[model samples]
Structure formats: C-alpha cells, structure tokens
Target: MSDADAPLSATPRTRLRRMSQKGRGDRGALFEVLRAGLVCHLGALVDGCPMVVPTVYGFDTTHLFLHGSVASRSLTTDAEVCVTVTVVDGLVLARSVFEHGVNYRSAMVYGTPRRVVDAEEKLYGLRLLTEHVAPGQWDYTRAPNGRELAATALLALPLAEASVKTRSGPPDDGVGPDAALGLWAGELPLVATWQQPLTDPALPATVAVPAHVAARAGTRADRS
Candidate 1:
C-alpha cells in the first residue's frame, strides 16, 4: 500500500481490548482524528507517579510535535507515554439512560517521545505547531527569537503505533426492546464555531483586523 493507505502498527500496548469493533487500524484514520483535535492529553509517569497534562500539538506524516516550558516534567521524561486526542461530535440520547452514549472521534498514540535537540528541526516543528492552531498567525506574527526558543521544550513522537476509534449517528436502542418505551431517542449534534474576534483594547481603533483572521469569524472551528 501507499504511505497514505498504510496500516497502523499494532503492538501489544496499542491493541484495543474493549469495544474492539470501534478500533481503527488504518493510519489515515489516526491522522483524521488527530487533525480534528486542537488539544491532546499527554500521559506519562512523573517521579514514579502518573501525570496527565493537556497541551496543544502538531503533527506531520511521520511524527507528532509537542512543545511546552523547558521546566515541565511531563515533556522531560524520555520514558514510554500515551497521548490521546478526542473530539466529541454529539450526544446520543436513548430511551434509557443506560443506553445513552456520545458521538466522538478519538485516537491514542503510544511511544517513547524524544526531546528534539536540533535547532533547525525544533524551529520547523514549532512553526508546524503554530500553523496548526492558527492557520495564518504563524506568518502574521513575529517568529520566536533565540531567547524564546531556549525557554521552550519540543518533543517528537513517532506515529508508528496508534489506534483510532469513532462513534456517530443516533441512539443504538431504537431497534432494541427499549423501543417499546416510546420515549425520545435521537442525536443532539454539537458544533463548535469561531465567534467575532475581540481586538486588544490597547490597539488603536485605526488598526483593523487582518483579513485572514476576520474571515474565520462565524465559521466552523471543528471538522467532522
């Protein structure tokens, strides 16, 4: 298969033991879930205990890039870690509370992330991160200087082992015995949109919003 059609490598740890049907082995599926999310929860063992930190991330075809303060314990650890990204699409309301569920797309990546030391790669990774969160802001804003780069820590985790899962549509109880209850059963779709840009009060009224930024207002922030 081509790289885009390649399957995700499944190790013992990356295997799904529960809800096996929802597990996706294709690399494209994993990329899709990650692309739709802006944040990821990094799970690692810190000082012999478990710690999960929420942070923004960026990725390319080969790896995921995470950046944070140089002092953060979560990024410093070179041990194996689990990174998760989840995007909730809607709520599945069923006739019975027990049958209620959520519509979501999620991915779990397993690897021992390494700290990026090369200056060129670090800067490139940072650019990818900035552009991922805000499409045009990277070019519009000033690039990080030498001192700013020194204070930041960047980690690169290979996208070799991962899994994706997604659930969507209406309630599952519609055709089951609960259907006799005759209660409401449907999906409440959830959508996230960007609102009007709030300008900095310090900026003079003469400064107008940039076209790239202004165009995003009132648009969907999340991809299905």
Candidate 2:
C-alpha cells in the first residue's frame, strides 16, 4: 500500500480527551491541516522546564522535518516532544460570550525526533522545508554548500502518532435562551493574502522580481 493510502492511528498520547466530536481519524485530515499551516509550535522539556518554540516545518507522507542551528538545545534533546499546528479560519460570534469559539483546524503529533545525519537525506529534507514555506523557491535560489550544511541541524519526526481536530460553520447558540436576546450570531471569516513583493533597496534597479515570487501577489497565503 502507498503511504497516501495508509491510515493514521491515534496513540495513547494523541487520543482526544475533550471535544471529542471535533476529532478526525482520517490521515488525510492531518495532512490537510499541516499543509495549510506554515508555522508550528514545538513543545519540549529543556533542563526540566517546559518550553515551546514557534518554528517553520515541512512534512511528507510519513515524516515531518524540522531544521535549526546545530547548537539548538531543543533539537538536540532525545526526549519525547509534541508539535502542534493550528490554522484559525475565523471567529465564531455567538449570543453569549461563553458560547463563542473559533473556526480552526489543528493537529498534534507526539514522538521523539531522530537527528538526520546523512548528507543526501539532509539536502532532500532541506529542499522540502524550503518549498513548504515558498513554493517554487528551491529552483530559483542557490542550494546550500558544505560549510553551511555542516552548521545546520535537521530532525525527522514520524507522523504515525498524531491527531487532528477541526471546527467550522456558524455559532452554536441559536437554539439556546441567548438567541432571544437578538444578538448577531455568525461567522466572521478570516482570509490571508500575499501583498506585492518589495525589492531590496541595495539591489540594482535592473534586477527584476522572479516570476515565482511575483505570481503569488494577492493569492491566498494559507492554501497549499
């Protein structure tokens, strides 16, 4: 079976304990949430204290890749960690403040990340990471050389143990007593768009913006 066709199982650490109705079991859902997001919060224990770092990430069918400086303490630790990605679609305005919620898709993965050392795999993983943030960028930019690669660190975390949850649509207080108060209850959608690219002041005026970069103007930033 193909990696795309394989199913994702919720391990003990990933199983949803609250708001279970929003939990999604399909592997595709997890992939969609991850693909729609560019930033993720990595939670780990450093020196016996909880720490969460916001970082960029990339993922394939089976693994998620994270990169940082070689001296990063969080990436060097071998302990189990959690990575979470959330994309907020909108705000759910309800009649009652207590009933308000946000329209969002979120996913959490738990595991110990394995440090990547192979030169070929490291380059491949770095390419995936670069393309994930800016599509078509890998072809337009120069690749990293040996000295730069040696100073970088990469980690691979499996997607086998993960869970996804999503919430959308209008507010849920329509049938409650709060509805009689005549307050507006609906969704205020959030949309993210890319603005025009700005050229560096030091660059020569003859230098033109690349097609891949210019084409993204006014396009949705969150869509894969």
Instruction: Record all residue pairs in model 2 with backbone atoms less than 3 Å apart, i.e. clashing.
Output: none
Q: Which 10 successive residues of model 1 have the least lDDT summed?
A: 215-224
Clashing pairs in 1: none
**TM match of model 2 to true structure:** 0.97
lDDT of each: 0.90, 0.90
lDDT of 1 by residue, 112-144 (tens): 998998899998899989888788998998989
What TM-score against the true fold does each predicted structure earn? 0.97, 0.97
lDDT of 1 at 179: 97
